[model samples]
Target: MAPTFYHRWPEPVTEKSGSMVQSQCWGWKCLSFGLILVVLGLLVPLIIFAVRANSKACKEGLLAEQECRTVTRLLELQLAQTRQDLVGAMGEAATCNQTVVNLSTSLEMEKARGLEHLTRREELQREVEKLKEKLQKASEEAERLRKEKEAWSKQGETSFGSSSKLLSPLMVPVCLFLGLTALLA
Candidate 1:
């Protein structure tokens, strides 16, 4: 006959079943823990990177805002300075215009005075010419009168000479009257 398989003691079914169940439970727990660890690892770096990016963006925005404010302040200051310069230039131009007006007035006054002086000088020159003419006429008249007197004196000497008795006293009076008439003429 074939060698018969000997029947040994029966396997412990409860123990084997319990041990398998425990192993399966432990495997699921280990898998869940590993998955959790992986997720946390990924999330930690992502969160850190996001925070760093946000911080950099905030810093850049703040710097830009500060620069804008500075530029605005500089523009305002430049505008104010330009306004002041314009006002000063206008004031200087006004002063120059007033000076020009004063100079014009002075020039006009000087011209008028010059004209008056010229007129006065002309009038004086005319008066002097008139006086010279009058003097010349008077001198000529005096010279003519002197010449007539000399002629009468010569006639008297010739007609009445050296003989007061020959011409009588009556003739002497007549001769004197004639001499006076010639002198008057």
Candidate 2:
């Protein structure tokens, strides 16, 4: 009697509304399904061809990706430097922590022995505080360098997963590692 929100579909033009509705729904579904299949069928072969062609192109020219190889070498050098820095920071932190412990121990001893010079106790305390600060700074540097090393490692992994691995053998350790694992397995 009155228009409602549910009246969006076209009302049947004839008494055979059921048949017309069925045809309309089935026609759309079939057309859409066919289009999807056609698109996938065309796309799959095209993608495969592109991949093979790219690989073939890489195999053809060795120097074509010289820039990529140079970049990879630079990244590797940076990673090595980062690793060295992390190690140095860790060593410095360990040394500072040891010095703090030594200073703290001597300070306790000086207090216990009733050292006549209060200046000695105060000096030890100041040295201990300075060492603690140095230890904290060294620890933070180590952590930061560790994170940077990890980021560089991840970036190296992703960047080499493509044709670069095929073109440059030395920089792509992930592929070699995988191959070795596969053999071992």
Candidate 3:
């Protein structure tokens, strides 16, 4: 009989060639089983190798991840420290600025006081100069009056005694008033 396909599987041969068909079928079954075994043997090792490589890669990835996490934590700590330092520096700067402002204000007040003192000193100097001028005038007037009184006394001494006594008393009062005025000056 001619070979024919039956559901993509070889139909069992009839009894016209019973032993030959049986032997060929047995041979085919042995070959197919051996091929399957060979393929399985090669694939099992390949799968095992793949599994081992995958496991190793996963372990390395986990280790790298752990290292990354540690680095991230360290970086975060450094960032926090840097932020604290910045805040402290800023506070110091603010304090310095306030100090500068206070010093500037103090300097301005001192300048104003210095100006007022200078004006007061100048006014006092002017008053002192005026007093000195007044004292000089008074001294010159006193010298002139003394010379006039000496001349009058000499002239009156040769005249009548009564006129001399009257002139002496009047001159004494004028001289005493001038002396007191000079002392005050």
Clashing pairs in 3: none
Cα lDDT, all candidates:
0.77, 0.74, 0.81
lDDT of each residue in 81-135, candidate 3, tens digit only = 9999999999999999999999999999999999999998998787667766765
Instruction: Give the per-residue lDDT digits (tens) of candidate 1, residues 46-93.
Output: 999888868978779989999999999999999999999999999999
lDDT score, candidate 1: 0.77
| Stretch of 10 with least lDDT, candidate 1 | 160-169
Candidate 2: regions farther than 4 A off: 1-65, 115-185
Indicate which candidate wins on lDDT.
3
RMSD of each: 19.9, 48.7, 10.1
Q: Model 1, stretches more than 4 Å misplaced?
A: 1-71, 149-185
Cα deviation in Å at residue 34, candidate 2?
Answer: 40
Error of 2 at 171 (Å): 99
By summed lDDT, the worst window of 10 consecutive residues in model 2 runs over 163-172
Model 3: lDDT to the true structure? 0.81
Rank ordering of all candidates by TM-score, starting from the highest: 3, 1, 2
